[model samples]
Target: MSRKFKKVVEYTFLILLACIFIFPLIWMVASSMKPEANIPVDMGSIQSLLPSIVPSEWFQTYQELFSRFDVFQYIFNSVTYAIVVTLGSIVVNAMAGYAFSKFDFIGKKVLFGLLIALLIVPAETLIITQFTVAHDLGILNTRLAVILPMIANMFFIYLFRNFFKAIPDEIIESVKLDGANYWTIFWKIILPMSKPAIATVGTLSFILSWNDYLWPLMVLTDSEKFPLQVAITNINTTPPVYTNQVMAILTISTIPLIIVYIVAQKYLLQGLGGSGTGIK
Candidate 1:
């Protein structure tokens, strides 16, 4: 085949793959717009996509969601958890990463190895232990129960360590010559240069905190204190599972994440690229 033909074929394949990935989201938005009775009944056919055929309940689903749940409170809870966890993760992970990268301590390698080993252990394995600990601490059913366990993410630590490791030793040495401490160097120099990694970790942390359901469900029994995802699920499981309402909840819940990714896309890409390439 000609070069142009080969390029066209490659582009076609990629578009098809993208469509496969994106179809569920499209279907979700479409279902949210559909009438409540028609959602599940609509078959696996393109007829659902026809704007004319699917009666647009543009505001009805949203209205129902608002009336049924304390949407703003749930959103506030989600935002509060996400922000707190993200900020805490950044500090803990960055400091740990910086130590691993720059400091020459006994067992540094061993400790890092242990951290890497933790990646293989599924989070589900620790849920029971975590719950017991929370109960012992008298923090269960509080927001602290949700935030405490997730504050130190291994992946973010690895990312920050790698990024910091790439920084020249000369930078630290020069700062030390000015009688600056490690903390000063980190605060003044290292952090300013680590925005990409910060953004990457912050975005991931926010998403994890925001979408979390099971752990929060296990801990928080009060509807007033539930995060958005848990609240949405609770609202979803009423006498009748209103399909449109569920879809609407999903769509609305997804919007903030989408906006965050769009805003942080550039930094995320930079962070991943830098981490992969060893942070030139």
Candidate 2:
């Protein structure tokens, strides 16, 4: 076949793949527009992508969601958690990463090595241990339970360390010569130059913490304390004919993530591109 034909085929395949990936989102939007009784009768499986034959009660699903739960409160809780986690993770991980990158100390290599090793350890393996600690600490039902663990993550630390490593030693040395302490160099010089990396880490952390369902389910028994995903779980357990409400909830849940990604796209792309692209 001609190269032109091959190019056309490749484009067609990619377009097909994208459509397949986005169909669920499209269906969710369609369902969110649907009336309560008209919502698709999905049995907790992968929901149907096909829109209902007739669009009906657009307001009731949202109405029911509002009545049963203070969605504003849920949104506030999610936003607060996401913001707190993102900021705390950045501060903790960036400092750790900077030290790991720029400082030479005894056992530094060993410590970094341990973090890399822990990366392979599934979080599920530690959930029970974490639960025990949380229960013992009396923070099980509070926002602290969710926000505390996220303050330090191996992956974000690694990203920060690597990003800091890519910065020239001369820059740090020069900053030090200009009467800057380690904290000053970090806050003023290193961090300003590392916006893309920080944004990347912050965005990912926000999304992960926002969408987190299992841990929240385990820790927060109070409906009032629920995050967006946890709120959706409660909505999921509602009576059988809740198609529209489920769709509405899912739609609502997806919007924050979408907005965040859109706002951070530039930084996210730069951070990802820089990740493994650096020369030692």
Candidate 3:
């Protein structure tokens, strides 16, 4: 085949793959705009997937949603929790990664190995223990309870460690010769250079924390404290089954995370690719 024909084929294949990933999101946005009376009855029809732009049913749905529930409060709670968790995870996980990469200490290998092993363990298995610890500390039903357990994730630590390990030893040694302590090096040199890794971890951490339903549901009893994800669930299970309102809320809940990923996607991809290579 000619080179031009091969390029056309490759582009076609890529577009198809992109469509496969994108169609569901499109469907979701479409569904969110539908009226309760128009849903289920109209589902799977082309009309169901095509949102009415002139009247904009989605806006009406959102208006009803906000009127009924404090949706803004849920959004605020989600943003606050996600940001705190992301920032705290960056500090804690990055520090642990840096220590594992640069420091020589007792049981270092064993500790890192344990951390690696933890990556294979199911997070669901730890819920009871995490709840117990939170209860013991008198933090249950508080924002801290929701935030604390998620701060030190193993995958992020591994990402930072591998990324840090890839930095030249000569650079660290030069900084050390310049009377720099580990903190100085970390704050001034390491973190700034690790932006891609930071972005990767931050984006993932934000998404996980933002979308977390079960933990927040378990810990936060007050409706006022409910994050968007849990709040949306409450909407779903409530009486009369306002499917349109549920869809609208879900659509709103997803927008911020999508915006975040779009903004940081470049760094996220670079960080993951770099970490994968570094680990080998």
Candidate 4:
């Protein structure tokens, strides 16, 4: 095939793939609205998906779910945890990444080398170790138990390290020459220029932290402190299977993250290729 023809085919294939991925999301919304029988169908009940089409008890289902459990509180807890983790991880990882990318010091290379190695270790492998620490700290049921472990991400630091390293040394030198110190260069110059990379790490961290069930489940025993993901899990029961309720809870759980990505999409996109701007 000609180069232009191949490029067109590639883009066409990608669009189809995108539709394939997005179809499930569309179907989820559709399934959430349908009467119970319609859910098991391939396309779902078509009428329920229409915004104006209302099931008789449509509003009541949402109200019933919320009233039965403090779903709002769960949503709040999840949002709070996700936000705190995102900000903390971003700060710690960005600083670590900047240092690893810029500074030369004793053990720097070794430490970074070890960090990279740690990324290969599955988080599940350290559950016992983490549990022990949580037990010793007496914070097993607290939000802190879930929050503290994930702050300094090895992968994010490494990502920023590589991205920051691509920044020209002359920018740092120029900042230094202007009587600005290391902190100033990092805060004022480097960070603003690295929005895309920062957003990349932040977005991933938020998604993982928000959707996380096993780690949070292990740590938080209190229902009040449970994130939406945890709360959703609790709603599942064996009989009469409230599938609509389950999907409603899931749909609620998914909304804020969707809004976040929609809002931050530009920055997220920029972050992937990283930036090539002069920091100074």
* lDDT winner: 3
Ranking by TM-score: 3, 1, 2, 4
State residue 120's C-alpha deviation in candidate 2, in Å.
1.7
Tell me the spans in candidate 2 whose CA falls farther than 4 Å from its real position: 1-19, 40-57, 266-280
* TM-score for each candidate, following the candidate numbering: 0.83, 0.82, 0.84, 0.79
Model 1 per-residue lDDT tens digits across residues 73-170: 88889999999998998999999999998999999889889999996677776889888988999998998998988788788888999999999999
lDDT minimum window of 10 residues, candidate 4:
271-280
Residue 163 lDDT in model 2? 90
The runs of at least 3 residues in candidate 4 whose Cα sits more than 4 Å from the true structure, single-residue gaps closed, are 1-27, 34-56, 238-241, 261-280
Candidate 1 lDDT score relative to the true structure = 0.82
Model 4, span 23-76: residue lDDT tens: 667665665665665555534455544422456655555776777789889988
**Error of model 4, residue 219, in angstroms:** 0.3
The lDDT-based order of candidates, best leading, equals 3, 1, 2, 4
lDDT digits (tens) for residues 4-63 of candidate 2: 999999999999999889977887877666565445364233444545544455465688
TM-score of model 3 relative to the true fold? 0.84
Measured with C-alpha atoms, the lDDT of residue 225 in candidate 2 is 86
Which candidate wins on TM-score? 3
